[model samples]
Target: MRGKLRHGNVPLRGIAIVAILLVIAGAATASATLLFLGEQPSPPQLAAPPPIPAPGPEPDHALRDGQPGEVGLNPAPIAAAQGQLAAGTQPSPGHPHPSYAGEVSLLARDGVVVSRQATGFALRYADAQGPELPAEQQEKTQNDTIFDLASLTKLFTSIAVLQLADDGRVNLNAPVADYVPEFAASGKQKITVQELLTHTSGLQAKIELWRLPPPARLPAVLSATPQNPPGAVYRYSDLNMITLGVLVERMSGRPLDAVVHDRITAPLGMTDTGYRPPRDKLHRIAATEFETDPPRGLVRGEVQDENAWSLGGVAGHAGIFSTADDLAVLGQALLDGGTYRNQRILRPETVRAMLTNYNTAFPRNAHGLGFELDQPWYMAGLSGPHTAGHTGFTGTSLVIDPGSRSIVVLLTNAVHPSRTWGSIGPARLEIAQGMALALGPPGHDG
Candidate 1:
């Protein structure tokens, strides 16, 4: 401890003590510098991560064949619906004749096809006045029987227009005249494409385009005028869709039928759906009304609407024929937000827009683009503020209920013998009600 220091006047022991103190001081300084530099002196304890939110319920599965019980449906009602449909093929006391000659119905819930039934005959009448076809020559309704969709064709036309809008090829808010300059004539300059879609364009409900010479038909529709001021009221008009069909053709540079097939049916794998189905498919096609004015006999495998026939089996208001299964695919596609079998024909937003009620000004007629919304007259028990569907004059009806994730497709040849047959409203109500009842209360598990 009394030894001398090597280079300083301090004793060796004192020097050792000072060195120790300095070393300790340096360490403290280094720690302070680290602190000043925002370095952690030690790894701090971390908080437990917030609990991950519980996983939401599973999404609906893809459409497939399933029993009623598997999808929370009561089979009794579904069977009853089938019974009613079968009964409809025979004459009732109130009505001396059948409500419809034949029908094919498909019902699905949560993407499961609970029932697909075919009843009666597709080709029953020999003529509009009667004389039943020989049983040997009659074609029984099949699940795949193609039916004339009538006004339901408007839904396709609407989809085509919306697709154009989605592609940025057409503007929904733009005037029709902007796309087809001839549409501007006769004070139609202000009629918007949306107006046409929602049936607010004030155009006449229909015109005898068939009466006009074939060359004049298209021109007449292009230059047609409004019956009332644009958006003044809601009047469902074939002219609207007819005009839109022309617009689709012009914008897509393809025929309307081709566009629907390539973009819609083909993508959905709907093989039995199209305008002017191939000759090979005629055997599976349902016969519609036997017309006299046009002198079309036994209208089998041909369009039922006169104007559509006059237009070469392709028109917006009516023409496309389809089977129940194909339409069920379409309904599911919409329910799944416009996709089926991995094919997306419309964006989810476009689907939402198509389902949204646009005719708030006209309460009685709630329309969404081309779909009739909350229409109880045809939608029956499934009718709701969000339920969307359409009726074809050829006795076809499609009901898609978003609330329950259900679809009902009732395709009938109600006009097979004649258009004078009574309304198929009762049958439409029965099937839809059956579906609604089969679904039971919400949150019910099979």
Candidate 2:
């Protein structure tokens, strides 16, 4: 909790973090230009930077496939993307990797899979000299291998709330206390569901609910004192989603996982995605941050988020693991304006509304109803006036570019061992940029 956004009156981190991201983005753009013109740009300079720490072992699979030379995309999408990307620039070693490494990925203009490759191992233990990967019996990570989608869980909760609103079952404008009466405790009666989705709630984040005893979780959550006036600023609190999970259970007459499965993942055909992964399926799950706090030792197959872990591995803000391929389905569902593979997860209008900016007053937060939008930082080359995505604290990122009709997913275990190890910023950018470099831009929808 001490590492929370230094200020409570506003959103997580700072507005300047956005600006700093923009500056780095500008440099990446410059690098793209140099590479476009046939000049190789220098690799990003890391000055004795602490190792790019990751949870579990280094993803031995990051670069195992789909490198530019190894994986070639269909010419049309690649040509368009190249032209659009080549604007006022020349081409260089475009689809390259940072020191942390990344998988080469490709998504179609229509969200169809055109290409994919896993160029690296999924575990350091698999390295020729390191030792042994997680388990030889475990399946090696392919481009389609499922990843534990960490915080992407919030998007599902947000969409569920929107679906309820569309059916007139819930009101975003109403206070949360309307359904969860005790939610009004601690002067939170004025907070609306919309505020929770947008993270404008005044809840002080992260009270180490997991560290506290079992019975204390509820009181600690209810006792989360406000750092500022309700709606005064934007502070991302895991408590917001936890409360939302509780609300879903109360409103839907079932557990939170049931609502998500019945309404979201199942309908979307995200077969490999969910909370409380099955015992038999553990071998396929990638290892994430190894825990020490609760002294759980190596964390594999379970949710990686601490707050989500505290809540029985199912919460609003975190606690969902998914694979890149499955997420592609979800991302395409949104890009299709709510329909995917003939199934509809949401109406087009609803999808658009979900992606609309609700945090104009809190530019630092720059969030859509539940989605973070146009963030150039972790968004990498996919960033633009219309790029939208969100990053999980556990080294995962998703960037969608409406302008290009593209989506890039980068799932990593940067927090594998501990939260330390500088940042995965470069890897995020390279992953998105790699996809951008491959796809170029779109012409028209068929």
Candidate 3:
């Protein structure tokens, strides 16, 4: 009875064993059912490492008038810079004439126009001989006064070429002869577009295109020979850009000036920037040198570069006239990676290529595709491997410091009365240093 104790006349021990078996079977069934229903327990999994984030795009800030403090800049140095510029307009000891006849300077940090100052007379001298114009007859320098861009025109030409490259219409590494077949003359068949852009085309510094008749000038550039082997040395040459202008015209089936206006200035809203500004805008134009050799007197409302003037004021090397404010917009656009107010003139990568130092083999002559880079002579405190700028013979400069996100533009008619007045190098350094100092130390917010 102890073993088989129940009412069914079966063994109690057997029943207990069956009950234990049933409980084991039920547990197994439940587990099987859970697994079949997709509720199976999973093995432990290690957590995944967080993903690395990509670098953010540069800020596309639009320019607006603001105080220096608004952009973490000290006002003292900037103010001092303004004083220096004002003093530059006055006669100094040793130098009988002012450093520049007139000037328009602009300093912008993070797209804010911290300082915009104008001083002196746009039309000061009667001629290149130092006779001052009668006071009432002279036009004072206004903030909007347009000055000849000189070599800064190279920057625009470069942008036009790069735009073609962006459009798959041109290859940088291709020979110049590919676009403008006439460029192949005089051992230039091997000269690459990149070499021309970087001034490493081994071309001579310049030719007297102005000496040739106007119709012969363009043809002369096409047949010009390189001074050295292609890519042998970095020689800043006007021929390189003149040839490039021809190439641009041929490839686009449009005049170089029209290409620049429709593509660059128009998109950037640079109302006062163009080659051969309209006759109506003459009153706002600054006067330049009085050329006796060319017999052009009081070169007002015209390009000052003899070669460009000879080219009908639309050459690639020097012709564009722009105000400090318009140029500031250009600097900001470049700083923001080639877009301003939603107008994308160049892709960010194209801009990167443009500002990249291609002439690394050349030491102090560091040059990008279309800009001079790390030029401490003019860049001063703002000089760095990434600092990009260009200086015009007409006493205009545009310095863009990526590290500081700042721009300093000093447009002066240093050659207004005469190119021999003095070197504007001191003024360039002062303005750049002022902006750099105002931004405080590197990496400092203020």
lDDT of 1 by residue, 1-446 (tens): 11011122222111122111000001112322232123334321111111111223324356789999888888987898789888889888777888899999999998889999999998888778878988898889988889999988999999999888777677666788988899999999988888899899988888887889999998888788788998888999999999999999999999999999999999999888889999999889889888887888779888989989999989888999999988998999888777887888887656766776666667677777788887756665566655799999999999998777789999999997999984688788778877766766534334
lDDT digits (tens) for residues 169-267 of candidate 3 = 877767889889888998989888878988888888988888887788888888987889876688899999988898889899999999999999999
TM-score of the candidate numbered 3?
Answer: 0.87
Report the C-alpha displacement of residue 41, candidate 2, in angstroms.
54
On residues 1-446, what C-alpha lDDT tens digit does candidate 2 reach at each position? 01111122211111222332211121223422232122333432211111111223211111112323233433443434333322211112452222221232344444445544443333333321223346653334456544566777888888777777665566665778887888887788878877787788878776788888877886677656677776778788778877887888878888888888998889878888888889887766665545777877667778877767877888877878787777777777776666666777675555655665556555546666678865656664455434567877766777776655666776665454345532556556544544554543333222
- Prediction-by-prediction clash tally: 0, 41, 1
Model 3 residue 445 CA deviation in Å: 4.1
Could you tell me the lDDT of residue 66 within candidate 2? 35
Worst 10 residues of 2 by lDDT: 45-54
Candidate order by decreasing TM-score = 3, 1, 2
- Which stretches in model 1 have alpha-carbon errors above 4 Å? 1-61, 442-446
How well does candidate 1 match the true structure in TM-score terms?
A: 0.85
- Candidate with top lDDT is 3
| Alpha-carbon shift of residue 383 in model 2 (angstroms) | 2.4
Angstrom error of the Cα, residue 72, model 3: value is 0.7
Scored against the true structure, residue 127 in model 2 reaches a CA lDDT of 26
